[model samples]
Target: MNFSITRLEDWQQVVDKILPQLQHPILLLKGNLGAGKTTFTQFLLKNLGSTDEVNSPTYSIVNEYTSPKGKIFHFDLYRLKDLDEVYDIGIEEYIDNAYLCIIEWPEVYEEELYGMKFHTMNIINSETAREISFE
Candidate 1:
């Protein structure tokens, strides 16, 4: 799916459309700094029935939240320098246990996902709007 929107509330429309299409546990979010990746996540978690406050996991690396559906682990791999750093965090264990994992800046760890089934979304920020491509 592809979407282009200028307002933040439009994220809910994107989330509502993608929510049912999400059949995998891992969702790789690719975007540049200031893109709406975390913004999209907030809408997603809210639509998933989560009441917990949502925030970007940039510094913490990972943040945990609960929803009626199950546990959700949000990850930000932007600061990780290597795959070893990714492994050190026990990403596999988290993915194995959580119902869903929304990973922002997934480029660093995506190679480890070979042979794994997961969803991918890319957000491109343009002068006028945010463009999203999802699969």
Candidate 2:
């Protein structure tokens, strides 16, 4: 499914559309810079009942958020040049322990995550609005 999010408020509907179908618990967000991958993460975390702040993991690589449901690990793998880096960082542990894992720049390690039930969220934009598609 796809959604056209013109404003932040449109995200609530986007969340409603996607969250219920997230049985896989793993999401690969593919988007260009400023295309709203982080925004989708924020919605997911907030809906999971997390009160803590949600921030991008661009530099840190991973940020953990805890809620009553479970812990979510958000990862930005853009800086990783090879799949070996994922293992070096003990990222598999996070994937195993997290109730949800949302990864940006997952193309860097897509082959490693094969066989996992993962959903891909693609974000595209025009001059005005960001369109998000999930499958």
Candidate 3:
């Protein structure tokens, strides 16, 4: 499915629409800088009952949040130089935990992620709106 968000408030509708289809534990977010990946993530976390602050894991690599359902691991692989760095940080361990794993810049480790089952969302941004397509 695809959705268009022309305002920040539209994020809630997108979140609501996608929440029911979250059969997989992993979510792979694809987009360019300023494409609202983090913004969409924050909305998702909030809708999941997370009261804590949600921010990009750009420097930290991963950020963990607690929701009413369980733990959520948000990962940003943008800074990793290679797949070795992902292993160094124990990404496999987290991926095996059966919790929600929201990943940004997953293209960085595309080969490693090939076997994993995840909900992929590609966000395309225009001058006044953002288009999100789920696959």
Q: Clashes in each model (backbone N, CA, C under 3 Å)?
A: 0, 0, 0
Among the numbered candidates, top lDDT falls to 1
Best by TM-score: 1
53-120 in candidate 2: lDDT tens per residue? 99999999999999898989999999999988988888889988989889999997888877878899
> How many collisions between residues are there in candidate 3?
0
Task: State, as a TM-score between 0 and 1, how close model 3 is to the true structure.
Answer: 0.95
Question: Mind giving the per-residue lDDT tens digits that candidate 3 earns over 24-117?
Answer: 9889999999898899999999999999899999999999999998889999999898888889989888878746999999886778776777
RMSD (Cα, Å) for all candidates, in order, is 0.6, 0.9, 1.1
* Model 2 segments more than 4 A misplaced: none
The TM-score ranking, best first, is: 1, 2, 3
Model 1 compared with the native: what TM-score?
Answer: 0.98
Model 3 lDDT at residue 6: 95
Where's the lowest-lDDT run of ten residues in candidate 2? 108-117
Candidate 1 weakest lDDT stretch, 10 residues: 8-17
Local distance difference test, candidate 1: 0.95
lDDT of each: 0.95, 0.89, 0.90
